[model samples]
Target: MNLKKHYLITMIAILILFFSIFSILTKLFLNKGFLSIEKKYKDTQINIIQTLLENEKYSLSNIVLENSYWNEIYNAVENKNIDWINNNLVYYFSSQYDYDFIKILDKDKTPIINYSKYDIDLNINKIDIINSTFKNSQQYTDLVNIDSNFYIISSSPIFDGLGNKAPSGYMIIADRIDTSKLENLIKKIYNFESLTFLSNKNIYFNIKYSTYIPLKNNNNETLGFIKIIPKKDNIKDYFYKIHIIFLIIFFIMLLIFIYFMNRIFETINSKIKSTVHQIDLISKGNYNIKLNSNTNIEEFDMLSNSVNNLSKTIKEKIDENNKNYIEIIEAIMVSLEVKDSYTVGHSHRVANYSKKIAKKLNLKNIREIEVAALIHDIGKLGIPESILNKPERLTDDEFDIIKTHPEKGYKILEKISYMDNIKHIVRFHHERIDGKGYPLGFKGNDIPLESKIIAVADAFDAMTSDRCYRSKFNIDQAVDILNENKGSQFDPTIVDCFIEVLNEDMEFKKSFAL
Candidate 1:
């Protein structure tokens, strides 16, 4: 992937993972924290209900104790005034105090009288319970379930109002838990909404924010359970709301970050492409093409400026080197003209003909062929002036010496690094397409294209020019000689192209007008 897409995907993935983990961790933290808060609230409500129930039991016990201390009740119990006991005690306590049941028992633990407001079954085994629980105290209180009804029971011993006599009987009073004031206290004062009385069997193990208060007899037996539920906690909902808000904010931030990142990448990518385009143009010899180095990015702008500077410097150096190379070539030509003036003219005509043929063939870098043609006979300078400008035909040995010029020209141009490509063209210019000519006898396609063009131009110039052997041939004779030797001594395509150039090209005809 490109920089923009790769960076975008990576950042998106990282942010998503971070948010996912953050969300999970936040949820877990909230759950743990809320669980602790709910538990504390539940415990607090349970403690309040326990206090309310205890207060109720205490109030009932106090009522029983006051009634037990009445001398009238004590005297009545002593004299066995059953009617007085029934009318005064039962009617007074039951009607005024909302007691579910009132019971009077003798010191021997025999029940003397029992009155129930609701006429519930009084099958309680009170003697054993009273004796077992009152062995240590004269007053007692307990929560009991009788006939499927839960009650808070309080018992105290009857005594003389003078405070001198022992107790005559025991007074026990009870209030059913359902009709008791505890429920109203829990609901009104404590602000609890749900209160339920459940038998031990009906009590559930799991209840939402519900507290269980057990009602037990004096024997510590659980008779029933009280369930109280408080209001639902809204903190979890609030926390989630806040978490959602944070997530939305984080997502918006991520989008903003991506937008800015895309802009940054686009800027960087555009600058790089612009720099690369300028460098490509320079590589293709368009050194005059300038790069815009004013991009906002510092490093890329610096690189662009550096590239522009390098291109300018290289172009300047190349121009200076080219001028020096032309001066050297001219100086060499002057020396060659001093040795054999004819050969110097011959080199110039060959160079002109090679340029025309090269252009006619649509060859690339026509300047390279022109340069190679100009210097193709540079090695002839090594030959004696007698052989170079001889007025007669050369012997076999002298011809052999003349043929060594191409190799000498290769040596002369080899030391110049800029002429490396055309040096082989100079060495192989005398080679024939039939493998009959040259130092290495290279055949046909084995010869460089520039060398083949120079060979045709050289032969044409030699045929038309005055030579040590004979007078120069006429234009028609020269054309016929080139056509006759097309595939043997010269590249046929280049020879044909040169003949067409001589006939059709106005520049060539004017330059060589006979």
Candidate 2:
């Protein structure tokens, strides 16, 4: 009787261990599977929203272009016919076309006629005409934020009767994006819980579970975001039900074969427990962990070998991924260089100069600083190549468009979570030390140290490199310029460090042909 009791106790312990291991593995697998399914669904919904927004912008552009290209409208605006303007542009177009706001601006961008369906005032002075220049006939669309309200704005130049010469003025149309309109559209198309349009300030709310997609203009600058809050579903409950059913079957099988299967079950359970522990270590980023299989069971040995191989494979893959990431960054730099002849090899030189300055200052994370310097002008990709390579000085409107590149670069790099530390450096590299720099006018110490370092390097490279508008400056001339604007335009310390670095490395200076 005592022997039978001992056997029963041993069988019960084995069964408990088996059930515990099974439950953990099942839970891990099920959770991963369900999460993947949820991600796919959410991604699909976000893509739909992006497509819908693009289509809306396209439609708005078409509407504005139709009115702007009319010869009669162009002649009326040029001749300053008040009766023609009021009857056709103000009353007829505003009422029949159903635009929220319609305005005609002269060559100076001053409004000739302003009409609004809503109470919000229109600020024509703040409107950007970078993409709507008379130099080209292309229609431009932008998401404009005025007084905390967003609008889809389209601008097209009004050409003369001959339709061949420069435009006399611009015809502008805007459609407001209100909460009711957004909610109605979401319900009609997505059938999701709700869609929220968020500004940069409110983007952090419910970030983990919600889908936050950046809304970009025709220039690819991020204007705002579309946040999708998905309706909750029973994915977890379904997986839980499946797990319970499997556990029941497992418990029944163990009970039926308790006496006969005791020794075999103990061996299998021991091997599985060891495997699980090693896998857990690997999951926790300990790729060095390994398992040993001496059970003499073919299946157990194969499983052990597979786990070891997986660890080795994972390590190799991680190394390869790191290498590939760096290569990709370099490739992007090369592509940017290709876009503007003046900036060819500009990023590489800036990176080299930044690294030297960083070393002189004994800054931490020097590699990150170098990488940021290399891609400092990545946002220039969004700027029109014509503007980037334009030989003449930029107009106020053109410079405003140029100033948007830093923010554009920030948006692009922020998408890569691992690049968070360096992204700010890329964004603020153009910032002035005196709080006069663009996108965000951060002052003095508010600018990141890495950005300060890159700013000096970027300026040095620009001065030394030949541009479309001017020839390259000699070493003394470039250094003098840096010394001249040290405190106001650049961090004085970083500028001094770079100057010292250039003096110390004769070979590097020779490479620049200084």
Candidate 3:
């Protein structure tokens, strides 16, 4: 063979070797990475479902607690006022609480008033289960399976009145954990495609991709399993797309290298070297770098212009991808807000406030801080709407559930590579400088500066916004509250900067005006 043909054969061999290595690495690294991420995503979804179940139990317990501890109910039971029990307790529990079974037992555990939604005879086995588990020292809140159906039962000792310690009898409220209820909760929280509750099967399946999370009772005994059939088009697809893009770029680079090698001896060496350097810059993400080829050869000039045009095209695609990413993030934030109507536009206001504070403090990456502020509450989507929109005060349990939002938000955003920088900020936005914050409770300088800024902004907007339980605070009151807790709940420097920002910016001030 001639020299050119010999060179071509040698280059083809090299290309084949390179392709084999690339394919192996892509499978080992890219596929493995995708599997790892898929596992994490499924784990997150399972945790979310577990949290949702816990919240539902807590909510049901609260409902039962509210009714059981009331004075009127206690008096009605003590007086043996059958009419009062039938009219008030029965109607209220059935209609208002939406409980499937309402049973009021005497101090001796004798059933006084038994009511069921289906008008069937009260299950003697359920009463036995309640009696077996009830402790005089504490209230009973648990999941009980009655005749193959799961129910969340809350049993509280009946007191004579609020703050009364002596128990008269027991008030038990049971709500069936029906498929419809679980589906609704899953839909609200995750928007998952399909969720199945499996019973008495091997919890550990040999399946490669199926997700299985065990459903446990309050006692931590595995009762059943939640099988989540994940949506096929999940976040893994996003990472796969990234890998595909990398593969495409690799091929383009390889072809360019081969083209340059073919012309190495014939073309002006300087021009080929310059074109290769430009390609290197493009590979390094400096897409604006251009080649000034003056070799006077037609091929050299055409190659230079082609490289430049490719750079522009790549830059445009990058810009478009960035724009699309921002839109997706905004859409996610909007979806979270939509779940709780009372907090509509709250995130936007927080972002604006955060940006203003960042500017006032002369902070770097002001845009990133603002974006973090916008998504700080994304975890709130995991919280139940009943707790979020509750017209009354939140119980300590409810508040604890609410506090998990920051961590939930962090878990969600941490999965996206681009969101790594802001994930901690989202997680720690509620952190106090005094180490009293939840999730991690990082104190003072340990909390991220972005988080600190978002905290102040979050607090100000929360206070200024009208909520279901409280009227909107006037600007002065909000400012005074911020000042009161500056060093304790919030970072002092961020607070001061935010206060200055609010005072100087009329538009920002007017935006929060009551």
Tens digit per residue, CA lDDT, model 3, 400-454: 9999999888876754666779888899998999999978978988998899888
Candidate 2 residues 1-514, lDDT tens each?
6987788887778678766776677568546655554464455456545544554665576556556667888888777666788897777656875678877777666778877888877665566753444446556788876676778888788886446867777787888886677676455445456667777665576765567877776667777777776565334445565566556645654664465464576676666677777767765667788777565765556556655665565565455445645765775666678766766888888899999998888888999998998888888766666678788889898899899999988876764655788889898888898999977998799999999888888888888888767899988899999999988999889888888887898998888774
lDDT of 3 at 348: 87
Question: What's the lDDT for residue 50 in model 1?
Answer: 56
Per-model CA lDDT versus the true structure = 0.71, 0.73, 0.72
Candidate 1 on 56-121: residue-level lDDT in tens?
Answer: 665576567657667889999887789999889888887887788888887676888977868676
Badly placed stretches (over 4 Å) of model 3 are 1-5, 117-134, 145-148, 188-194, 200-204, 231-491
Better of 1 and 2 by TM-score: 2
Give TM per candidate.
0.45, 0.50, 0.62
User: In model 2, what are the clashing residue pairs, if there are any?
Assistant: none
Q: Identify the leading candidate in terms of TM-score.
A: 3
Give the TM-score comparing model 2 with the true structure, all chains together: 0.50
Candidate 2, residue 189: Cα displacement in angstroms equals 27
